[model samples]
Target: MLDTTKYEETTISTTPACQEDPTGVNYRGNLSRTIQDQTCQAWTSQDPYQHTKTPANYPNAGLDNNYCRNLDMRFTAWCFTTNPGTRWDFCAVGYLDPKCQATPACQEDPTGVNYRGNLSQTINNHTCQAWTSQDPHEHANTPADFPNAGLDENYCRNPNIENTAWCYTTDPETRWEYCAVGYLDPRCQATPACQEDPTGVHYRGLLSRTIGDHTCQAWTSQDPNQHTKTPANYPNAGLDNNYCRNPDGVNTAWCYTTNPETRWEYCAVGYLDPRCQGSVV
Candidate 1:
């Protein structure tokens, strides 16, 4: 016996959509291997969305490979094709299209630890309720951890460390204590710690608070007596004063040392304040 249903012919229909940008060129990958891609490459490499660049030709670029399934390090969405019926349909997210493909969840970490990485993150949002992850170190924008203020001579500071505070910036020229906000905030506002100048910071070694891009030099601990003014220990024997601080107390107090920096050096800690005592007292 033959079933008539087997002979019934069915028409295949595929839903098509206009190629639109869910995220701009910034969030898009290279063009979908087309003449437009070659045309874009021939233009300028500086801006992806230059004159010759066509958004419709390329697939979306993103920090994350997930196409609306997983959140980025900043809780933002990546991939996310605008074309609904296309092969690159957003998975896991189901149907409702996200407005911004590269926006972070509008949420904040309840524990201050999370704040160390996302200071600029928003607080209390419905869309961002599900996102929560972080990088290893701290972010320097929140008001949670009251970063300890390190003196010019202090080094090896970390937010994870029990007693240490955020290692603020030091003026290479003036050698004054200042926060990332650019002030003499001995009590740095509780915020994410910046690793840019992780080592050499304001009011640190030499004490002058001038802006020069220099990575901070890490040491075992901030000990004044430990770092003696020896030829080997001091950075530049003829150039800068390489000595442990005086007084030996933690937090900006220079330890006892004989080789103080020059007295008139405006940027030196001892030069800014008499207590630093540029010369061995």
Candidate 2:
């Protein structure tokens, strides 16, 4: 028996036919016309898997994904991984790659020197006239030869120039002359006692003896009974009378009127009399 379904290699088409036309010939043209036509129809009816699976041609594939997204790529990825907001583009750019737009590139003075931030006159060329900070006395116009006039003792004594008594001169002669005779001159209001004459009679020793005719005097005779004439020159003379009377009262009063010149007279207590008589017998 002859097999009508026998396998024939020539019946199948190796080249795919055009999907748009069923009667189109396959590119190899080795298949039966019917098989070619049916293959073309089937290919036209089915959706192509390659067209869906293959990626499209993109113009900027090499660039980072976040380049057009307004955020740094690394920061975006970090935010995504850390569960942060993806909308914070500026913050992301600051965190990943900070731009110098907000922050200045340099902090220097007009001369391109680094600023020390202080306003010193010595370093900044600021004169006392231009700025008061340079002034040692805070802009006071004190003269260059201004007198200090510190603690003048003469000025303390006399304060006014018109008075002609101010003692502000620095001359040594003037200073000595002003202070001279301050102790001895009674006009000096503050003179000290020790500065007066030390050996003068005003400061002599104390008087020890009483002054009177009864003042003790020495006679030439040693015996108390001997009659001695009063010294011809007595310091303060009184009646010249002498009497021998026992001051101890051991003997009775005696009167010897042998001669008026030889008579012995006893002077009364506190009196100098020239008469002597026996106890008024």
Question: TM-score for all predictions?
Answer: 0.17, 0.10
The candidate scoring highest on TM-score is 1
Q: After superposition, how far is residue 175 of candidate 2 from its true place, in Å?
A: 86
Error of 2 at 265 (Å): 99
Residue lDDT tens for model 2, 53-143? 1112323222122121111111111111111221111111111121212222122112212212111111111111221122222322122
Task: Report backbone clashes per prediction.
Answer: 39, 4
Off by over 4 Å in 1: 1-132, 138-184, 187-211, 216-268, 272-281
RMSD (CA, Å), candidate 1 to true, equals: 22.0
lDDT of 1 by residue, 22-57 (tens): 112122333322111112122212232232222333
Each prediction's whole-model lDDT (CA):
0.23, 0.20
Give the best candidate by lDDT: 1
CA lDDT, candidate 2, residue 250: 25
